[model samples]
Target: MKEKLSFKKGHRGRTVFLICDVIFLVLLMVCMLIPLMKVLVDSVDPSTYGLRLIPKKVDLAAYKYILSKSSLYQPLWVSVYSTVLATVIGLLLTTLAGYVVIQKEMPGHKLIVGSIMFTMMFSGGMIPTYLTIKQLGLMNRVITCVLPVSLSAYNIILMKSFFEGIPGTLYEAAELDGATPMSIFARIVLPLSKPALASIGLFIAVGMWNNYMNFILYITDADKKNFQVKVRELILSDGLSGTNIGISEDMLKNAMVIIVVMPFLIIYPFLQKYFVKGVTVGAVKG
Candidate 1:
């Protein structure tokens, strides 16, 4: 009788827990949705500038005005080129580093990993970094914005952990088959590393896409700023003065928020499967 009661109690508890989980998820969706709906509705609303659940009239002038800015194009181009270059370089270095460190027979494997991890704990101060960049004559260059920030210690560790999860027999077999390290990496390792690559590449791409501090610090040229910097200026500034575009600050702000996040929303769905698998693999192995 006691065992029966205990089982009944446990079953009831699980039912309650599941219900609570569903409730929590619904509430979270509501919280997120309300803000998104407000932004979407307000961006096109011609109504007076105040919070409302619905719009009086749909006016798309804000998006049109913002899109028409010639200044926005240069920053968009900068972000595109810089993000692509940075992701490519970051993935290449991360893959190479992860592959090398996983080869326990390689000289200084632990030393290399330890050195990489040490960076996560400490960094040269901003002043010293600035001086180093200045000395290298890279202060105002686009490379300055991407190269320094590209190789993340965290990503390297994650990649290393992911690679470690791969079966060692595969490497041994390749070696026995007279496969060179480069050939094995390109042919065998890379084919199996797609999940880790997607996860890390997405991380690097997002980081570079949203990067602004580097541009703000390294580049002095007004025309060379990234979209993030331009968005910051737009959000913080008094409404575009001396312009005939009849749009409110709130509309532009909402539109900017949507524009910035839209790319990730579009890209993430495609990579969701790989990202989930990769993150799980890296996390468990690490």
Candidate 2:
């Protein structure tokens, strides 16, 4: 009778714990859902109902207005070009660095790893970074956006950790087969590290796509403006400031927001599986 009572108590405790977990999860999801739902509603709404939860009317005029304007296309192209270039370059450099540092016998590996990790914890502030960029003669050019911040320490560390998780026997086998380091990286490591690579690439790509500070500071030419900076100018432009800009202020603002967010929304779903797996693998290994 005592044993049966104990089993019943255990079952009841588990049921209570599961009920609490469900409640917590529901609340967390709702917190995330509310903001997303609000954005969708606002994006479709004709009128900006200030601070209201719901819109009185729905319309796609804002999207239409933004898409119809030819002026937005150049900045969009610039953003795309810079983002793609940066993502590719950054991924390659970071992966190479990570792969090198993962070698246990590499000379000064500890010092290199320490320095890289130190940079993650410390940074030369914006003024110094801007000054360095100016010295490099990257100012007022599209390359300024892609070249200045090509390699990130956090990404290198994550990639290194992922690489470290691979079995040492694989490296030994490759060595026995007369595989060069580059060959091993290209053929074996890369294939196995897809989740990590995809995650880091997406991260870098998103950062590049959303970058405004680099473009604003380095590229003074209005013609070289990225989407975010261009959007900012459009948002702050009062009707009296420019009669020929064509698009209305409210419509432009909404449209720019949509444009900024749309790419991430579209791409994230496709990479959702890899993203989750990469994050899990990195975190577990770390």
lDDT of 2: 0.82
Q: Name the best candidate (by lDDT).
A: 1
Tens-digit per-residue lDDT, 166-215, candidate 1: 89899999999999999999999889999999999999999999999989
Worst 10 residues of 2 by lDDT: 239-248
**TM-score against truth, every candidate:** 0.90, 0.88
Error of 2 at 77 (Å): 0.3
RMSD for all candidates, in order, please: 2.4, 3.0
Q: Give me the runs in candidate 2 sitting further than 4 Å from their true place.
A: 1-19, 47-57, 239-252
lDDT of the candidates, in the order given: 0.87, 0.82
So what's the TM-score on candidate 2? Answer: 0.88
Indicate the TM-score of model 1. Answer: 0.90
Q: Model 1, residue 39: displacement in angstroms?
A: 2.6
Among residues 3 or more apart in sequence or in different chains, the pairs in candidate 1 whose N, CA or C atoms overlap within 3 Å are none
Off by over 4 Å in 1: 1-18, 48-56, 239-243
